[model samples]
Target chain A: MKSKPTACFLLTVVLSCVLVAEGNRDVNQEDRTIEWWTLSTGAGEHDPRTDLNRLIAGEFHEQHPHVNIEITPLHVEDFKKRIQIVVQADSPPDLFQSWGGYVMFEFARQNKLRDITYFVNSTLSKLISRESLAVYSYAGKFYGAPYDMGAVVVWYNRKIFEHAGVPVPQTWQDLLYAVRRIKDAGYVPIAMGGKDRWPAHFWWVYLAMRLGGKEAFDTAYGGTGSFTDPAFIQAGRLFKDLVATGPFQEGFENATYDQQAGLMGDGIAAMELMGQWAPSVAKNNATTGKGLPHLDVFPFPSVEGGKGDINDVMGGGNGYIVGKNAPDETLEFLEYFLSEGVQRRLIEDQGIIPVNKAAARGQTGPIATITGLITKATYYQLYYDQYFPFSVGEALNDASLLLLTGEYTPEETAAAINAAWREFK
Target chain B: MENIKTLYSVKKLGLILLLIGPAFALFTTFVVMPVFQGAYYSLFDWKGIGPLNDFVGVKNFVRLFGHEPFRTAIVNNLKVVLFSLLFQLPTAFFFALLIGRQKFPGAIVFRSFYFFPYVLTEIIAGVIWRFIYNPQFGFLTQLSGLIGPEKTEIAMLGNPETAFNAIFVVIFWKYIGFHMILYIAGLQGVPKDLEDAAVIDGASPLEVIWHVIIPSIRNTIMISVFLSVIGSFNVFDIVWAMGQGGPDHSTETLVTYLYNFGYKRFAFGYGSAVAIVIFFLCLVFNVLYQKYIVGDSRS
Candidate 1:
């Protein structure tokens, strides 16, 4: 009977520890824990990226014995849902994954992010590129930095291109001709994941970027111009012309991003407009698990009679942003995470394009080519869906889907986008 | 000693209140309060955070009604409800009539077999159906390819015209067994004497069924219809896993439309407005259903 009370006391102590696991730093002031959340892209629970991140965190902990890192790796959709709640509550993790545009700006505007401008200017300036860092900047203050970066380009199957007997396209007309030829050769000309919406939206983004360039985007985004501008309409018209050829695989409207990658890997589709992550997804989805027999990328072709520069690029990348309640050690961890040593490993094993300038030298093959394309670009436009406010961006996606389906004319599509833009604050 | 009966009744009432207190509190806190809170939040243009200062009354509703996708969602939901009543449940009733007789061989076996679809989770069913509907390598596509002349390709969920109906078929399959089982249970209560009386009175199987078994199982049918109507309004998982209400929102239902355009877009105010509309829809439905259709049975 005496032992019963003692047992209850011990149980209470254990329960308290369990409850305070997430509340560790709150109770003990001396213990600084950096809660880092990153999105795990693959289906597997044990993502290599997360494993590498844990290793890096271990190293960091060794260096700073006073600090600890609690890593929470979530899937893409789960991360999006969780981040919104946490940031809105103003009790976000110390460091979390960020795509670094409208959403980041929204968070920064709400004073949820730590103003790490000084850290960037003093330490990270020498490590990462200006373009990658600029995305995290809201009203002249840096909040984050990217570890991996790449531009959106047409990833094509070289063997399929060889079979179709088409040279690399340099102009809009040339791309159209190549697409027709490829389709006639009994292969899907352009593999589009219409169900996902973003994959189909990229065509419109590239076309708009090619036609209107920075001037059109800036004028429209700044509210000096409107989405119903002739440039946007023209972009829609060109995309419609591409749609006329029925270049996508049968039932493209329901095809998810994974299916698009699968087609390319299975050697059924000629090309796809995708980011650097496309190849990895294709490899996993491939029948043989080796992916495409011969894979290559070329810059999106220039549109004739357009104001845009031919070398202009449109893309975005993965990065991290700090919460307002982040510890000082969070900056140090960011620095180490984006350092040359770690980044080189990322490039070598994961086939990631590093944002670190020193680590860029290690990139070879298609990744190296992408780095070159991005570097020589006179203009780099972020993906419109990410760059614009949440609702307006989603409107663009919805409009783009309608455009590709040929349900709406170019004028109608542009009008739809403008309507949504008008409603946005 | 002066009021013993009253004192005992008061004690019993006190005991009842004490027993019901915790459950009542929980129900009000979680369910009732959220409904009222959602109504209040529906008025403001709140983004799930920051100040609730943006007071935009009735504007969210106006926009929601005018929205094209929301209209599609409403129509799709109505189709689901209509199909459930006119077709799915009727078919289930027919099957129940066939198997409800204990004398029918393999009656339990058929019931178990029919109920198998309901055993699978909504998401698992969706994923399995997605594989069967794949345009390139799907089972249906391959089977059609063997029969058709032009190397037949059928993208059931891929086509906007067919996607909703295609998913509806899967949903119909999933729920048919449930209603059939409900009817079967109701049939057990239907005394054999009345059925025998109808047969002796020169009534055919159809007429006898209409007069006798149908009247006896009226309560079960009402409950089944009510469940089906509510389920149609709230259908999300299968549709979501299948297409996420895509192919231009062709397969969109009310709840899916809310998730896609509301929460996913971070328009919490709009989402709240959607919730309000759905609440009123369900509430009105429940009230009308209880009062008009099955009120007598309750009384």
Candidate 2:
């Protein structure tokens, strides 16, 4: 009887051991995969992130067989707000789209963004350009990957120009002449949207660049150059002069980006000083057999003796970044994205420019021309508000709009900018 | 006797605790905690997510005094308060008196129509107003065209001279409905015997409303005025959506300016300072209102 009880106990112990082993095996299988969250604006019925998630998931699973990417597309504005909240909550995205500026730099400083120099040196060096990589650099550390270059260029309505008997402007003087002629023909010269202060920033920055070359811009942004400097004041004056031309739509200050683009699409304006992404708008509006106005891109023209040339760039690159908290498997997904084939897919299929050097540049439109300009250029200037300290950038946007709308004189506008900078510093 | 007294006191204590516990916990989490965090953030020169920030004491406030847009934002907030006082409250009171007691044709329908706008979210109302004020396609411009082509380009929300008023019109359209509803409640609460007695004395409708209805609804009037003041001071979403407070910061409110400072420009410290100023201003207004206006109403 004692032996029977002992035998039963032994049997139970062996079975319990096997069950524990089986449970551990299941956990081990689950441990190899990773979860990735991509911040995207889930617009329309079909989310673009869903397609990207599927592509990355397919490749990642095939290669590692142990990784999974979980993509959640938040609204565009919500994405930025969520990052701050989620990071504070101790759970952030694995990878996301990041503008290589103060926002990303702040993340990098906070150690929320991984210093991927170690990984890039070993695996991603040959895949990206040195110039492209430089964009993601801050304080001597490379933080993220450059995904797309948002190079600002002028988008002109060719049919409007042809109708007005004015050719495409090749120089600053030529641009003014074209504007005058277009005005005489009773057509708005430019479709600028001042409703969003950032859009109005383009004119100020362009004029600032024209008046004060790169060195002057560097000096001004560095807190040494005065906004009250003759050059800055002159830029403000130039802005006022442009506004006086009555070249913008009647209610341009109320016009949204869509409205501004719509004006060009409807032949209400002759040209738009915008980024290369404008061709996408053209393509979108070209559905009718009548088609959109013939579209062309150009660089901002030179000032009389200023060193800024027709080829000097006024743009920056947008890039994908891996989170510092991302698991190692997430890095595998980035490697796939940095590949030439995927880069080409982004360009040819999605209209986004790829940062990879090996990506074939076969896609047409403003991306090709912008890439050409980038590759062939000798010098470049970062956009103004991008480089300005936060408070001053707001002041710049406000001052420019206010100046154009007759709220501030040229001198007062310059003083306001300087005062804001003083406060910021 | 001692045991009975102890039991009574204990029961009272427990009841008090039960009554206050939920609200205290909620207030700590939502209000007190955020205020403390904002105060702490104001001390640091943090650009959102960064490693180390320089702690600058009171510099953010000093900076605010010198910044022009901040000044403009304060001025603009004052303008909004003035506008609400001049237009929204009086109009709402007038309509409430005119319509509250009547049984005219479609009176209920008209009351519902007046109340409809208050039901809309601010951004939706802003969009509707945007279309109504649209430069090229809006009915306003179409009507303006009846005058002349030059007048047709009035640029209602885009022109600096009119942008603030355009935003005010939208705010008025939306919130006047709320005030009207409040006034309806107030008017209903007014004693019908007094107004009937005034009419028997040969008082006109306007005279009866001015003397009897006005005094009776004094408490509601006080509440409405105070709410309008706070609402106007904190105006943000409508102004933000409508031309983004632009055509020269003509419509920029303290809240929108704070938002732009913090989110758009990444000056969290400066934004927090602006927020604190707005907070103090609200506190002052509330205190003054309670001390003077509420006391007057009671009297």
Candidate 3:
């Protein structure tokens, strides 16, 4: 909240005051309590997304009567840290948000999570596709289900592009040229939240996908190859060229992701690279509570002579997992929360790319574009941080940051990630 | 008489143990034991929650020494200590002379003004200063933007080169007042007749300060220096609140380095190793400083 505008706090107060529907909530009639921790669109109590979450929890509580779901919405980073502490202490909240990857698997390996494989097989499988739930599965046991899945793409302000006379870029070279034009037009070409490192990793990871395709990553992870392979190093060099352009906002290296969202929401910068949730976050961070009027997204551009197709996707999703100590009612609440109605609400209001296929039937424009890419993709890669242990993921973010800051050469950046992989593995 | 003498020696031993035994045991268990415990833990490759079976002896230390950020943390910590001593000395002395020597109009007001930042919590001071150093619409940037080159933002904490200096400035501002207050109190202990006699002997004001005030406050200055050095090694909240030892680990002190690499990465073994390193550094400094600079004149 350093340098955070006062209006967001005031607005949160106003929004939090906005009452839920009368039918949504009632005092719980039972003794059992569930702690439901979630990753919020904004940090702390200054969240816009939590209203919808609170509404869902309240509705769930009303119907259940015996099981009270106490919602704790945390910012993404805070959520990770808090959950890590709780999980390590072996007193995980009844249920908590999970991105469904090595982190969740780590929890499962430590026997900290409740195995919901039987539930997934009998009940949830019919609703959420098996492939989507595969993320939350470890060694053939399902622990959670994905409610939203999408790809990282370039979110841009059309007004800025038009003002700069720049066309939508279709290739890496075009993107670079567009950045220069947009910068020359006196707008920050890229609104990077560099302090939050992961945002910058998307640049390198996506480049690696487009350059080396999925094979490089698979081989590297399988120990047949290494992250220091040519494609990974090449990704670093390309990312370095983009950083050399100086397209981000002033003081970008220390700016939080929220600040980046605010910049996009305010249309103070031309572009940001983010997932499906970008628009809602930008709106929440915006001065006007309505983000860029001309917000549009384009797929990450392909590099020339790259082995990967343009449709090869780099993405992940948001979901929930149950603690081992969770009451029997926790699954019922999670299932209800992931039911079509709530998923639809999440999609419509929060710009979520819904996991429930029925809920995503008619998304038009930018969202459909993302959904289509994921559906038709030759490869779909989870975020490196999510795919690997948290430490390796952090090292990847750090190494990418080094490349972005010109602190590490491409080969060195590649070596750093590889070293962490070997060490942590 | 021999039997009485034996009883007296035994009684003396009993009295000595009664005075020092509990404290020694407590110190060994709480203070001294944890350092050795940390040293033991540092030998294993353990995450925070797991078993300590992976006995990678001294591997953590080897990695720590090879880690660039830890080296940076050491340098940054030393710089903090040096800056506090070098910058605080003159400012605290000047203020002590200005306000403590002679009370004038609004002298109390000036003292309060000088001491105000110290009263504010370190985190609050850091956060407030972070806003002041904010890259875009910050007070400093906005003001400088008016006179500086157009479209060139001078981001103090964002640039790796300038971030440490920016943090140092904040640290200096936050603690200088405390040191000044110490000096002021020290100034009060200076004998008035000694100063007047020196003046009567035709000593200049500078000479009087050098000969009288400086020597008189030596003990206070020693305590302040010790605190400053130890506090520098322990500085975490301010640097962390401001930068998290970032803009590419440019502002990392030893403690933040310990936190980021050890706890954050969930590599508690490496973190304990870092703690041991910091412990030894502090220990070495404590022994040398006490034995040499603070010798014999403790009273």
Candidate 4:
């Protein structure tokens, strides 16, 4: 009996010591650490973006000596998959990259994100554009902030256009004419990456935007209409028409995005409908290492008699969302990171279109062209995959690709999308 | 004496249990538990995240059977199975017989060369093959160019009809060595005396192989068939790494279908349903095989 009492007392003492050690660890953790998960901007050994990130981080550390910031950089696809697992495990990094739209909305809906609406409306509101900020917003509440926003545009090889004797297309008919001329000139008109289905979907989505503009999308997405709307079907039909012209390179259906970039960079293909990252990717993938001597941007041409203005754009942006349990300093760091000076540095060096209104001043060349389109746009729509639920987004990509292959008619494609929406909505 | 023998047997049983306990525990925790959990999850309309409150019952299964892509996936898996039995196994067996026990100069080099592909990871093999299949700038194009300039560009993977066949060729190439090695090991067990007796009886080489060698190695053949069939059903990494079961989902296997529909779309419930279907398919095949082949042979 005495031994039992003595053992109980010793057990309590040991347990209390263990508890105290754990308590100390918890306090130590709270005092001085933040984890940031970001996508690596470059694939090679000498990446200036990584250097810039470190420079900014060093500056931040100097400002806040007590807090230590740890950045874990991952490749884009790896980051996406890892982040999903991390978020599901309920131990997301303090700050992490997000491509704002339905995916972010899903995270927000699940209460996995920290609501930064207060910070957005108070201090950072004046710094970034509302339109750019809207990408990261969900249900009228801000969950993240965009640092880089860009529009999809036609990236053309100037030499190829001159060789074919075709001017830059300003209308759908003109674009079709250019395609015919380019093909007749013994070159593939467009370098498309159909194996990675998102590139192909861009064609259909852009057509939908050109045909119907914001109202058609709004009506369909707002539950007042259906995805099988005439405008959407017409978009599919137009995409099929483009596919029928044999615009894409040989084996394009199996070619990856890198391969498509290679084709454009090598001047084997005339044009590619891609984002701002096209030039850099093409340059990296080119046989010459220097890519095209003359590369230029043109907007996706307007459809004849369409409701959409030619200036309306289809695009999205990269941003960082705060995790649910992130420290207050995470938001502070984001604000510092997105300041005008930092944004300008990123723009000048990284070739990204600035989300900061003040930093938008010195933009030139292709970046300037995209910035101008964003500013003059009548309506800015996010990519369909980003804007819609995951299932519906996947269905859209599948349906669009099928339509491109002539495997599914426009009507059938529309029905497939509508059916997926019904099931998953 | 009887009491001493009983005690000794008890000790033997204790030793056996002790040896197996840790592995059994691990397998139960990791494999068996997850399999059961997956089955349970198949009953709900749950995303991978959050609580499992939405009980969907058999709706996921019903939907899977009705899905066109799933049907395509099933057919693709069957094609793989058929091809493996018809082409892959026979090729491996033929090679095994050719040099399995033969001691010639550079025989070891030949064996290693044949086994080289099996040593390469599935993803690496897929990537290498993708480059080889590239229409514009690949070895295939160069080879075709030798034949004629007009034949230089051929996109076998781009065509839906040929995509699955191309993947099948890679599968056959990568796994043939493994099956060949299995057959070689089985051949080593065949008694030389039995072959000599068949030869002495004026039997031809083919007859000797059919009557004596094949009967002796039937167990190994059965096991290799079992492994090949299971492997065909679970072929995901190669297909995924190559085309992501694309060019219009033509290369989709059952596992790839499960991944694309379930994990990619966050439809965990539906994915679990797919898992259950795959499990049952493998289970039914294994049970029937064991009963008809292994059990019958043993008896």
Q: Residue-wise lDDT of candidate 1 within A1-425, one digit each (tens)?
A: 99999999999999999888847865554768999998775647778878888898999999888889999999998998899888877799999998888889989988999999999999998998687788789999999998878889999999988999999899889999999999989999988888889998898888888898899988888889887898999999999888888888888888889889999988899999999877988998888888664889999999988889878888888889999999888999999999999899888767777889988885677899899887788787888899887888888888899888877899998898888778775
For candidate 3, the lDDT comes to 0.87
- Structural similarity to truth (TM-score) of each candidate: 0.93, 0.88, 0.88, 0.93
Candidate 1 regions off by >4 Å? A1-31, A42-45, B102-104
Docking category for candidate 1?
A: medium
**DockQ comparison, 1 vs 3, better candidate:** 1
* Candidate 3, residue B206: lDDT: 97
Give per-residue CA lDDT, model 1, range B1-299, as digits (tens).
75998999999999998999889999999999999999998888876768899999999999999988999999999999999999999999999988877676787889899999999999999999998899988987788868886566688988899999999999999999999999999999999999899899999999988999899999999999999999999999999999999888999999999898888777888999999999899999999988898878867
Q: DockQ numbers for every candidate?
A: 0.51, 0.51, 0.45, 0.50
* Model 4's DockQ score: 0.50
> What residue pairs clash in candidate 1, if any at all?
none
Candidate 2 lDDT score at position A383: 64
User: Arrange candidates by DockQ, highest first: which order?
Assistant: 2, 1, 4, 3
How high is the CA lDDT of each candidate model? 0.89, 0.77, 0.87, 0.89
Candidate 4 lDDT over A56-104, as tens digits, reads: 9889989987677898888887887898889989888989999888778
Clashing pairs in 2: A147-A319
Clashing pairs in 4: none
Q: On residues A321-368, what C-alpha lDDT tens digit does candidate 3 reach at each position?
A: 889999878888888988889988887777788777777678797888
Of the candidates shown, which would achieve the greatest DockQ relative to the real structure? 2
